[model samples]
Target: MKDLTSAVEHRQEHRFARSRDPRSAAKILVYHPEPEDYVVGIRRALPDAEVVFGSDPDFLRQHIGDTEIILAPRFPVEALQDAQRLKWIQSTNSGVDFLVPVRERLKNTLVTNARGVHGEVMADYVLGTVTMLHWDFPDLLRQQAAQQWKPKFVDPLSGKTIGIVGLGAIGAEIARRAKSAGMTVLGMRRGSARLGEPVDQYYTREEFDEFLSRSDFVVLVVPATTETYKLVGAKELSAMKRSGYLINISRGSVVDELALIRAIGDGQIAGAALDVFEVEPLPPTNPLWTMPNVIVTSHIAGNPTEYPRRILEIFFENARRYLAGEDLINVVNLARGY
Candidate 1:
């Protein structure tokens, strides 16, 4: 596989070479709620730039025409037509699905994301979830709710194998932690044959079935895209070991919700720990919510106490680069939809 670090650096350099002169007084918009210090930091970094903050759609729409840059988790695709001077968007979230709808309008604009910032927190969530499922923590919780005591034998993670579907920033971190816990790590990447310390074996998409068959825990970390939409469905789930667990910290669309519910109900796979879903807030009526073996968390795997601070660091660094006419980091490849 191409060294992700080098690939990103090369892309940044290429984009910087084509970049125009830095605007002396660009209008910036922060469409998400942020700490006061974050706004101060941006102002400090771009002294001459005009910065505005608002969470309302109307407010953002009114300012889109003059805004040159936007730092937000989500933006109204319909407002792109009014953003005459918009040149760049820095997404606070790692995934850029919010911008996918307006991709054509963004053809001339640069987009960057908070990719590296999420690795640690997300890894922690993956590790915790995997262990909880493996040790039957949900059953224990149920017993507690009944005011009864029960003990059950549990499998150890040390001797088991973990398959990480996406070997990106978050996936790599999960591999590292899983390896440290004594699990053999099997990783799948789109390209590159290089094997690393944490990963015992690397499988390309062609070997996905083999990867699934060997994993005791399958972790999904890939971004949501046309190619990834419902990437894991009935066939893939059926290929997994009956005792294996699935963990998804990626977008909900990556897994077919109906197939997953059926798989769990039919005992095709052991269980799943889901942090994201095809729908947010995961409606109370959803079967996954009521499934005994399933563990669900509201799309908060990457949210940590220091998330704002960490993301702000990325934004500030990129803002400085923007003002200094240097290459910005974590630049997104709009065509790849990451």
Candidate 2:
């Protein structure tokens, strides 16, 4: 496979390998909860490869030993223990942070993710939430439910500042949409060096508090990693404007759940729209469910109706490149946990 490299500041030089052709000795494991949905496409993509599809753990253990490639949104990390012929693993999900813990086990395998596909849908979701907050739609719905006709004025989004916590692919999409709305886009990432993106201002790692204080609506689009786990807590929350709103499309662990509840309860910040949570299905006893200012959505922000179509596209294209002994796209840098 091709070796592509050019330093992009904080980003890593992605490495790919010349893989064994499926027609030869390569064996592939196509794993999914519903394997029937993908079998045809997977087979069509790798016509000469030996492919096995299943979701059962026993089935996985039975076939994973000599598999050269495994494709799925998720699978048991433990199943990779004896995957000696595993040359690569294609993840249907964009974030590969979950594999950080078992980095040592995957030392020889190349990991690629569905990174480019989620940008449009996720950006649409984030922009939808932002407009809801800016126009006070939550309160308007409450009044409509109460049969009250109280009309109110709202500030326009044109002159507002939107701070993006992580400026990756999805974050770039969000920034583009926010900029189109005439809002000033402020972005913060670990890298201080600017690559000339669309953002109006770039905030360094040390300027987090000041960045938080200036935004009208803050969006969290970071991945889940040790450095980002509980990245937002009471102190971070307290730094924001009391009237500022928060939109988190990232993992729930990125924000401290307990601290978030207290911050909203105490009116430290205005409110939040959360798509991911620490506990899924968010227990009936959790206070976030009843908070009039909060919006709790199940983790459905990324994998919408067209998810399978886009993710499979990435998988097939990369499969062609891998089989042709060319560069594979979206190869992840495990050390950085993207």
Candidate 3:
């Protein structure tokens, strides 16, 4: 276990120490590659917990049955299913789709996420991609390759409608930047009506298509769930302004890849900047890879900066709350998937 990053330094270690209750501290298993990189800080955070850190799947499988709390980015579902005394799980990723495999077994356990951490970096990346989509950088690059100098007028970010789906932490940051750039920000989510939100207008789940039709640019940031699987399909694409562009920073399953390909081919939508796909490493034969109008990035929207220091932040706070008998933050609802 080697600390690959300086993320869990001394200061963060002391922040949690004051809040932890020695008597209430439970055994914590930090399962990650080179688990020691974070173990020192985690141990300092909850001084009384029996902190066993490991990178081996077999070691995790061997110890998981007696562990009360698990902080891991990856865990064998079979081992996860056998946890006897597990009370809480701190998932390192904002999206907990991986846990779907063990959702039924952990009905009694609490699940939380590292969501807000990616907000700033992800928003910056999404907005940059959105700008590329709007400016038709692909076309410009093609012209550059052809050595053709054709200047075309394009609308500025200001006054253009930018609709955000799944207005969570990432979406909110996007809205803030869009607003700063003078763009009209529209947002959709379960309870987007909350006052003081960054969005200029809010749409509910029922008005999904209506929401889709109005935006000049649509950004998908929703979680991948049964309700959101292929949330953007043929009809949904048809709803958008044909000139509009899509920027997906969400899971690939959230959008229908085949429908998106067909839509792009037929010009149902202008183009897309895709960071995720239905199948990762996006099969070489996939049309999106070669499409001049699309930008495909291997799922890296959340990590413009690595070292999940933010996830550890969430874990630290939650660990304190768990020991203090306080309500945890980022508690996930498995059924809704956010």
Q: Would you estimate the TM-scores of all the predictions?
A: 0.90, 0.91, 0.86
| TM-score of candidate 2 to 2 decimals | 0.91
Candidate 3 residue runs with Cα over 4 Å from true position: 1-26, 33-36, 44-48, 53-56, 145-148, 304-306
Computed on alpha carbons, the lDDT of every model, listed in order, comes to: 0.83, 0.82, 0.80
RMSD of 3: 6.2
**Candidate 1, which ten residues in sequence have the lowest lDDT sum?**
1-10
Residue clash pairs of candidate 2: none
What is candidate 1's lDDT per residue for 73-175, written digit by digit as tens? 8877888998876767889899998787678888767899998988999999999998899887898888889999776776678989999999888899999
lDDT, residue 313, candidate 1: 88
Compare candidates 1 and 3 on TM-score and give the better one.
1
Q: What does candidate 3 score on TM?
A: 0.86
RMSD, every candidate, angstroms: 5.2, 4.5, 6.2
How far residue 64's Cα lies from its native spot in candidate 2, in Å, is 0.9
Q: Model 3 misses residue 105 by how many Å?
A: 2.1
Count of clashing pairs, candidate 3: 3
For candidate 3, write residues 175-211 as lDDT tens digits: 8998989998999987636666778888887898888
